[model samples]
Target chain A: MHALSLPTWWIHVASVLEWMLAMVAVIRWGERRGETEWRWLALAMLPALVSAMAACTWHLFDNPIELQGLVVFQAGTTLLGNVALAAAAWTLLPERSQS
Target chain B: MTVVGLGALAAVDPSPLFVLSLLPYLAFLRWAAASKRFPPLALRGFQFTLVFVAVTIAAAVVAELRFGQQLADVDRLHGSAEAFLTVANLLVLWGFSRAEPGQEPPDPEASTTGPSGEQVLSTGVEPAVPPEDGASVLDPE
Candidate 1:
């Protein structure tokens, strides 16, 4: 908290909120279109959101040396999130179009 | 044997995770780019996430080299990296938030053709009469 500047905190918080909103928007869009697969896209966004929250939490604590493990956790989640998002997007394509 | 601080090792070794993440992200970009039905704005938004990753990596490297600090400890660098992610999320939200043209509900009063070739609608309009010259009436000469 004290480690990050006011503007830095603002960016962190806004990015998290935007991500959550995007997930909800994706879910709503899928439901509207009657495409159930979009829910998986929203699901795939979770790991990234968790990663963002973990980073923010680490900063909130001023990046304590003891809690540095959060950094690695963030990285792991980021990797998982990227892979999940890719899989979800791939599934959204028609089978005929999929390589 | 050399002693290593697990936390420090974990912190510094996240480069492996970052590198591995790129493989799936590239696959996603390829698929999204090829899919015609994928939302265009959302695809751009997805691409921006890669930009965010690249910026964050560069910022992290700079934090290590210039200040001998982790990116999270460098407030300005961290914030700048996050701003790209915020833009990416905003674009994704904007892309999916709008009602797609095909997703609109059919209007109950909209005209439909009947089995007998008559228009079926509560408030129907007459069909357009074709011109004798076999040209569309709305066509400009």
Candidate 2:
């Protein structure tokens, strides 16, 4: 396993921080607007956070390739993120009226 | 191996910036849907085309910086494709925005009624009734 570079660690840290801030912002905005959809969408940040954490662990352990556990976790997180984004969009946007 | 392949081919290869650019359209769609107000599809399409042109120019600059003068053909093609896709995405977004029902304007008759006994005296109309019982007289019942 190769050693982790400082730049790589910085990127991971930044990604984690960015996602965390996004989660907080979404949740706060949802609460202020009384939007349940936005609140649910905030949950999407969890996966991003998880992926960031796993990446951090991998770097710390000097593992270049992600473990299977990490991959599955991140995949699930990505899927949730997509679903949450779609749902939030649906709730926030106008819907077509059925005749 | 398959995972990396999927990430690169499915996710990373196509300019992530392109997808990011779609965020505005997605936001517009969401807002339009939630508000139950649909704008004209053609107007939306025009706006999208403008954005597409802007993004294409930006992409051309980036390609030039990365590829230098060696890949002029590639740069041009990349810009063209980016512009096409941006326009295409804009069309799709416009369609989505127009999918919702548009709000109708308020009825003119509903807005003409004034509070109290004062009749909305129109031009050339005589004050046919006294002001005290004007509302009761005007009432359909």
Candidate 3:
């Protein structure tokens, strides 16, 4: 049985970076327009942050069995983040476009 | 002798469970990316994410079914997955970075002009301020 992997860390770091970039864009636009949608966009990254922290914790301990348990947690976080993204998208109400 | 060390030496292997769970998410991402209301860059970044993750998940399924998790094969497959994920993340970063800050998304039903040229109200209108003097605004001066 294998423990956590580098790809996990890779995805998390990249995701955080991605979220940071998007957050900057959202904040710039959202503040001026009073759009609450950006809040959902920010919240969407919650799982990524949690996943990154968990990966670090697993790294410190280096336990494969423990990691097996942690996989569920990781998956849960992924679900959370993805769900938030979905919500953010919905809040945007893409069908409302005029131009 | 430690799997953690081995994992560090290797990469995160995709599990059947993880891969399958993401299927619905991938569907949602596909839909979101196609939506017109949001910035194209952000949605396009999301599209990149969808492809990369889907690629890895497909690879994992194939590797499991055909290769049976043989050590060497698993290593190759996991490495391949990581490579794809790296590209995916980079695309995500690039796509989002392309978005211009503070640009309002264009509305499909732009402000309409009345017969007398008065403009129709737009979305996100501010609430009417309460009357400080307790007088009805509807009353004409």
Candidate 4:
């Protein structure tokens, strides 16, 4: 198995940071909208955070090529996480006026 | 093959297609924000599409990882991330469309009517009655 590159590890770290920022933003948006559902959206980010951490660890310490499968899995999970976040955003954001 | 096409393009450059894939998601978000009537079905459809794309891209990546040597030209990794995000945006659109509006406040002036004739009579103020049909209350003409 090939060793993981520095870029791969960096990407994982970046993803974690991005997700964290998004989580905070979503929560704040939810509060402004008086939406209680934002909690669920924030909670959804946890899995992606965990996955990113795991993937980063695997890439940095383990065989990167073999870790490809795990990376793909985490990416898929992140997709779902993003969807949930989006849902919360929509729910909490003000709707456009019909007029 | 479709994969070959993706690979060939990726070999030459991967950024353009990756950006293209993201366009749909961005468009979806814009539409959802601007739209007035958020239908539930459309939202679900969008979500399903995103999840589908995400799964497909992930599968493609796994395939590439297993056969990376053969498809060395393909930037499967980058493509997968783009596809995942695109699909995620679609899901957001779906959820937005499905969201229901909050309950509206009750209308005023629905419950109370002005003081009736009997009440006015009790108060010693004469109540003016309107003419019925063509007949005038003030004059018979």
TM-score of each: 0.76, 0.39, 0.58, 0.38
Best by lDDT: 1
- The global C-alpha lDDT for each of the candidates, from Candidate 1 onward, is 0.74, 0.44, 0.53, 0.44
Q: DockQ scores for all the models shown?
A: 0.47, 0.07, 0.19, 0.03
Query: Which tens-of-lDDT digit does each residue in A1-99 have in candidate 3?
Result: 133356654544565565566566555444433455666666665666676465445544653443544555565567666776666666655454322
The C-alpha local distance difference test score for the whole of candidate 3 amounts to 0.53
Interface RMSD of 2: 12.9
* Model 1, span B18-133: residue lDDT tens: 78888988987887665444566777888898899889989999999999998888989988998998899788888777646232224322112112222211123344222332
Between candidates 2 and 3, the lDDT winner: 3
For residues A15-79, write the lDDT of model 4, one tens digit per residue.
45655665565455344334456576568656656656655554554534434445444544455
Task: For candidate 4, write residues B66-103 as lDDT tens digits.
Answer: 76632212335543443444444344443432333221
The residue-by-residue lDDT of candidate 2 on A62-93, one tens digit each, is 54333434444444554455455545555544
Clashing residue pairs, candidate 1? A1-A60
TM-score of chain B of 4: 0.35
Per-residue lDDT value at A12 in model 3: 42
How do all the candidates rank in terms of DockQ, highest first? 1, 3, 2, 4
Interface RMSD of candidate number 4: 13.0
Which sequence of candidate numbers ranks them by TM-score, best first?
A: 1, 3, 2, 4
Clashes of 4: 1
Per-structure clash totals for the candidates: 1, 7, 6, 1
Q: Cα deviation of A59 in candidate 1 (Å)?
A: 1.0
Indicate the worst ten consecutive residues by lDDT in candidate 1 chain B: B109-118
Worst 10 residues of 4 chain B by lDDT: B102-111
Q: Which window of ten consecutive residues has the lowest lDDT sum in model 3 chain B?
A: B111-120
Off by over 4 Å in 4: A64-99, B1-141
TM-score leader? 1
What CAPRI grade goes to candidate 4? incorrect
